[model samples]
Target: MLSWVQKRGTSEHRTGLETPLQGPKQRCWFVWDPMGIIFAIATWALVLSGAWVLVRDLLIPSNNVFYAIANGVVFHLLASLALVSHLRTMLTDPGSVPLGNPPGPDTVSYCPFCLCAIPERVYHCTVCRRCIRKNDHHCPWVNNCVGEDNQKYFLLFTLYVGLMSTHVLLLLAIPVLRSHARGEWNASSTVSLPGPIFFLFLVALMGFIFALVMLCSQMCSIYKDKTTTEMLHQNKHSQGRQSMWANIKAICGPRVSLAWLSPFHSPDRYKVSERHVMA
Candidate 1:
């Protein structure tokens, strides 16, 4: 969930309009916002297109052991995981604070604009038009808020997508570079890769760089047990009392040992609550 240039106070472009208060209602929080939707569409279109081309080219890689792993396992599993996590992050609601009256004294504050209870670590998202649980950032790529509910999916998506892109680039890089330098692909080669393959490789490399940066930033936030929002607004932020491992488990789930490393294996994953955290 990378929001590099997010205007923190800007109201949602379209959904910012406060719907007429019904007998008890004040505003709409479930309506769609077009700014994020458009960015998500364009970003995912490029991602899917590049992934397709990479997978197509790597279907039957060289008989060498390294290439075999790259083609058979890494390409299929990582790409699939990347796709799933991406979709999950995009579709999953990053958890909105319950509307209306405050549930309990635990709520740290109240949002005047939305007239909703604001809990600890949660903040109002102007774009989402709601207070998000453990609010992190609004990611235009996923067109969703990255908060307590979907942070894990967002992280996994970033890591897997970055790895997959790098893998594709590595696999095709030699051929692309050699061909470019020599001015022609080797005619005698058993597999004749398209010229566009080089361009695709370059594209994947760029994606890798972008994802890597996001991954590192997310990891740093996790290590500090802070959300991007909290980090950005340090003066106004207060964090939960959780250790580093507790922070990781909160996001990666109980099956992090297995699920973090593989997409095909979902070995009884479950979310940890605030009670599970250590001081």
Candidate 2:
């Protein structure tokens, strides 16, 4: 395949990524990997189930209508943001280099598996079946590779999830604390929670911890201007990179603002070329 690609004339290579099958493929961003699909489904199931339990068991039954309305609104808003961020992360293309692309002046190597020229900071993801620019580790939870284009959405997903989890934990704890303070509740006064409420507590606790840890790791990576893959492999080439704020801007957007927090906004610093598929 390498030989065939190499033997092709410049004009053939110049045709770029366009081909008969490219259009349909470009329209779909879903990865077909079984484990990724399963994890994605599980993620949606967890979010939906937890939200239902929170609303039906915890929020609706509250004695204070104002409290119930306020908490419910906040929880749903955070949950909606988290879900939107997850969808954007999964559906956005992660800056995959055009397959079978011709080597350029800055090309550092070639990916034999992909039969494409590999540029600096590019790594091939076997699961993605392509070379991704600034490729980070693939995330099963989001069912996508965290790479150049989609990193912003992934960060926002973690942030909102962590915030939502914290909110849930507070809602569960405050009432119990208040009862105890008034001497109306004690260890002997404690009663078992309903099944759905119990389930919600467990989910919130687990989600909080997971999101907290992942968010911290991702923030550190952004600060250091190194991806998880580069750090793990000890890629020396990543040294002498831009400063922390510059690196953050590069990934999130050109300027630091509320837009950086939005999953609907694309980073202006790195636009995908026409030759690249948006899949």
Predicted model with the maximum TM-score? 2
Q: Candidate 2 clash total? A: 0
Tell me which residue pairs clash in candidate 2: none
Q: For candidate 2, lDDT tens digit of each residue in 1-279? A: 434434443344465642221212366577788999899888888888998898888888877799888988999899899999999999988877777666543345668887776656778888988787778889999989998889999999999999999999999999888878999976677577888888999999988998999898898888877789989998877552447776787788878799998888887854333222221
TM-score of each: 0.71, 0.85
State model 2's lDDT.
Answer: 0.79
lDDT of 1 by residue, 112-195 (tens): 666754446768888888777777888887888888767888888898888888877777777667776886755565665576
CA lDDT, candidate 1, residue 278:
22
Predictions in order: lDDT = 0.66, 0.79
